[model samples]
Target: MKLYTIDTGFFKLDGGAMFGVVPKSIWQRTNPADERNLCTWATRLLLIEDGKRLTLVDTGLGDKQDDKFFGHYFRHGDATLDNSLAQHGFHRDDITDVILTHLHFDHCGGAVIREGERLLPAFKNARFWSNEKHWNWALHPNPREKASFLKENILPIEESGQLAFLKEGDLFSPNVAMRYAYGHTESMMLPQISYKGKTILYMADLLPSVGHIPLPYVMSYDVRPLTTMEERQSYWQEIVDKEYILFLEHDPVHACCTLKQTDKGIRVAETFALENI
Candidate 1:
């Protein structure tokens, strides 16, 4: 089995929104913001290749949205989903399974595309993976998260007759396991893969960046802030105890990090590229 980091691109988000109650003076040290108060974030995805079955963990924001819609987030980067896939000698059609952690626009938007007059699955032959709870939640999102669950980016996966809900003990491969986290969104699935004699967790918003290692550094977008703290505390300890390598999705600077329990608290023990492992 082999793994690769597919960097879709980068975008900017409000520093406050990304850091939640954490003040700019503190967060800006790790994730510095621009004069506009927006910080750069990477739309990083993970790809797993075990023989012929190629699974893509999460897709970044696609380019279907009009200029007016995209202007809000300021998506700017040299790498795209297609280009990134090709960089590692693959293509959209080669993907056999797509594991969408949640239906948030930034995470799953690139799964569908805009055809002349229709919205269609970008990976025409792949089965799109999402949990039943999260699917229904996205379909009828609350007013607070409605903006994040865009219909054009979703809906089409089911319309394409290729959407599959994860079952009990869901396994993308023999070595990759699906773990659930609810603090960020309903039934969000984080892929825990056993690679290179180590367990790597693909942190999909549960832990966006290295700066979020602190328990209180939750994002404002999380539906349940208190729940997020509790979840983080539990996993933070387990991650350190098990010495899991965390593959960060939105961290603009770092690709992966290991944790250390120090007197100050849990902090990054090491940071390096996935290939280095």
Candidate 2:
């Protein structure tokens, strides 16, 4: 199986919110914010190729929102979903399965496109994958997360008759396994893919960047921050013990990294591109 890093550009989020209780004096060292206190983050997508099935894990924010709507996030950068796919000699139609980690706009906005007066599935030939719990959570979003789960970005997949759910033991492919985290959102699935003789865990908002490696660096956006801490603490040990390469989704600077157990705690050991493995 082959994996490709689909760079779908970058956007800005308030550094304080992203770091939760962590002080700016610390997080700013890794993810320095702009004058407005907004830090740049990449909506990095992953493409998995195993024979005829080309599964794309999380399409980044699409190019459908209006200027006024986009003014809030300040989306920038040249990388786009279509352009990134074309660079790999592929296209939207080439994707067979789209594994949405969760239905936040930045993660699933590109799953659907605005066509004329109607909303449509962006990947015409792909089956959009999301769990029932998260799908329902997004559909009837709570006040805190309502802004992130836009109806225009979701609902269209179910309306288009292309939505599918992955059960607890299901696999995206023969080499890929599924893991769930509830702190960030309800039943968020993290794809554990076996590739190049190593396991690459897609860190979809679970650990946004290396700055979040510490136990207390949780996000304020999470529904249950304490649950998030427990999940992270449980996973960090397995990640370090098994030596998993974390594929970060929002880390602007680093694409992949490994964790090492130090006296300080589980910290980033080494960093490199996916190809380096």
Candidate 3:
């Protein structure tokens, strides 16, 4: 099996919202904000090449949103989904699976594209994987999360007849298993991949960045902040016990990191690029 870091691009998000309850003095030290108080974040995706099955973990915030909509989140960068995939000598048509951690616009928006008046699945031959609970939550989104779950980005996969739900407790692949998390969103699937006798946990929104290692640094966007705190504590304990490599999704600076138990709690022991692993 081979893995590739597909960097779709970078975008800006309100730092205060990203780090819920954490003071600017604290979070700004790690993720410095711009003049507008927006912190730059990477919409980094992961690609898994297992023989003939090419799986893309998540899609970045797509380019289909209108200028007015995009102006809010300053999406800027040279890297694109197409170029990133091509760099690995592959194309959208070659992707066999798109495992979405959640249906948030930033995570699943690129799964569909607008062609003329019709919205279509970005990967023509890929089976879009999302859990049943998350699928339902996104389809009938609550008022708070309605803006993040765009109908255009979603619904198309189901309409295209390419949507599949992983059964609860189902192993995602030969070397990967699914762990359900609900703090960030309902039934968010974090892929626990076992490779070379080591586990690489795809830290979707459960732990967006190394800065979020502290149990209290939960995102404001999370529906259940207390649940997030509990989830992080349990997950971090397991990460330290197993020495899992955390693959960060939104961290602009670091790609992966290892955690060690400290007097305070679990903290990042070392940060390095995925290639170093």
For residues 1-277, could you state the per-residue lDDT of candidate 1 as single tens digits?
Answer: 9999999889999999999999999999999999999999999999999888899998899889999989999998898988889989999999999999999999999999888999999998799999898999999999889999999988889988999998648786789889888888888899999998999999999999999999999999999889988988898899999999999999998999999999989989999999898
In model 2, what is the error at residue 213, expressed in angstroms?
0.6
Candidate 3, residue 45: CA error in Å?
Answer: 0.6
- Residue pairs with clashing backbones, model 2: none
| TM accuracy, model 2 | 0.98
What TM-score does prediction 3 earn? Answer: 0.99
RMSD of 1: 0.9
Query: Which of the two, 1 or 3, has more lDDT?
Result: 3
lDDT of 2: 0.93
RMSD of each: 0.9, 0.8, 0.7
The TM-scores of all predictions, comma-separated, are 0.98, 0.98, 0.99
Off by over 4 Å in 3: none
Which TM-score value belongs to model 1?
A: 0.98
Query: Cα lDDT of all candidates, in order?
Result: 0.92, 0.93, 0.93
Residue pairs clashing in model 1 are none
Ranking by lDDT: 2, 3, 1
